[model samples]
Target: MRPSVCLLASAMSSAKGMSPGPMALLPPIHLYRRLLRAHRKHLPPEMRLLGDEYVKAEFRAHRNVENPVHMIGFLTEWQLYAQKIEGDAWVGERLDPGKVEKMSDEQLAQLYELMKAIQKRGTEEGQDGS
Candidate 1:
């Protein structure tokens, strides 16, 4: 058995009012660490920093949550994202024009701004290197 599974089993056995289930049987901190490691290997430096910060903030915000249902949802989403990153399924900042057309004006504006910022940073770096 995986160390996480063992830890989860031990935790469930000791905690009152908590039963073993698939989600509950996966140790979240272990999973989070795995996701971070995967990100380090798969993501570009800027994107990795952003993703790591976002994940850290979200986990910290939910650290005190006692609702198992919500916790499971959060873990499931993050796990899927990690899997996508590790599988090389993510292409950075490249949305289809058709999909962009479907976005709300505010969303489009935000995406445009982000793209511009990334481009500007790249330009600045190129200038610095020369």
Candidate 2:
């Protein structure tokens, strides 16, 4: 739900006959947000944060500032944006995971940082065959 993503959603909502179904929604990225708004009330626990009818469906608010998911979306998109801005330095875009894996150790470390930034893994360490 980055500002750009919100704005994208807003645009979709404003257009006439923009049904909240898979077919009507051309871009899957935009469709993702609309579907959330269309079914906000019934969204599962994991998706409720992205479901805001008023903010996204009503006037199509330019991003839901209150939604925590938006922050994650912003950071994820920002990661790509940063790499894009440093285009020359970024040897491989996020689009090329295979190339990314073969990147230098420094690039690998940077990618790891991006992966860990929003990670929410529960510490479940357990003893194996010791």
Candidate 3:
């Protein structure tokens, strides 16, 4: 096994209730695969297609990131999103107001674009009755 996976496994096995710390995070490839798997297993076909594409693009865009903090934050958020999907807890949930307030303008713009895409897809799906 890769060193990162081994570290994650050891940390998980050793730390029952507490966090396993930063080094225990899943590597980017592992996290990406997990997210794709979660979407495949849980999402409807159209949503899964959109989600997989988005995840792939985002991972590709971030692949050359040199800052560890930004990379860790990105992976951690994606991990949380995957867990939410796997647990069926993402449905009917709204973005938290506080979290929205914390977003930078660029992040907000990306979120707005995503919301528009989702609405567009929803409208298309409604028309298609699928």
- Top TM-score model: 3
Q: How many backbone clashes does every candidate have?
A: 0, 0, 0
For this target, which candidate reaches the highest lDDT against the unseen true structure? Answer: 3
**Lowest lDDT block of 10, candidate 3:** 1-10
Q: Looking at model 2, report the run of 10 residues with the lowest lDDT sum.
A: 120-129
Q: Which tens-of-lDDT digit does each residue in 16-123 have in candidate 3?
A: 788656445677778889999999999999899989989998988886766655666777788889889999999999998998998999989999998899999999
lDDT per residue (tens digit) for residues 26-127 in model 1: 457866797899889998887677668767877777676666555655676677677778898876535567866878897678667767866886787799
Compared with the true structure, model 3 gives a TM-score of 0.80
Worst 10 residues of 1 by lDDT: 1-10
**TM-score of each candidate structure, all chains considered together:** 0.56, 0.21, 0.80
Two-way TM-score contest, 1 vs 3, winner: 3
Candidate structures ordered by TM-score, highest first = 3, 1, 2
- By lDDT rank, best first, the candidates go 3, 1, 2
Superpose all Cα atoms of candidate 1 onto the true structure and report the RMSD in Å to 1 decimal. Answer: 8.0
**Candidate 1 regions off by >4 Å?**
1-25, 92-130
Candidate 1 accuracy as TM-score? 0.56
What is the lDDT, from 0 to 100, of the residue 79 in candidate 1?
A: 72
Checking candidate 3 for backbone clashes, the offending pairs are none
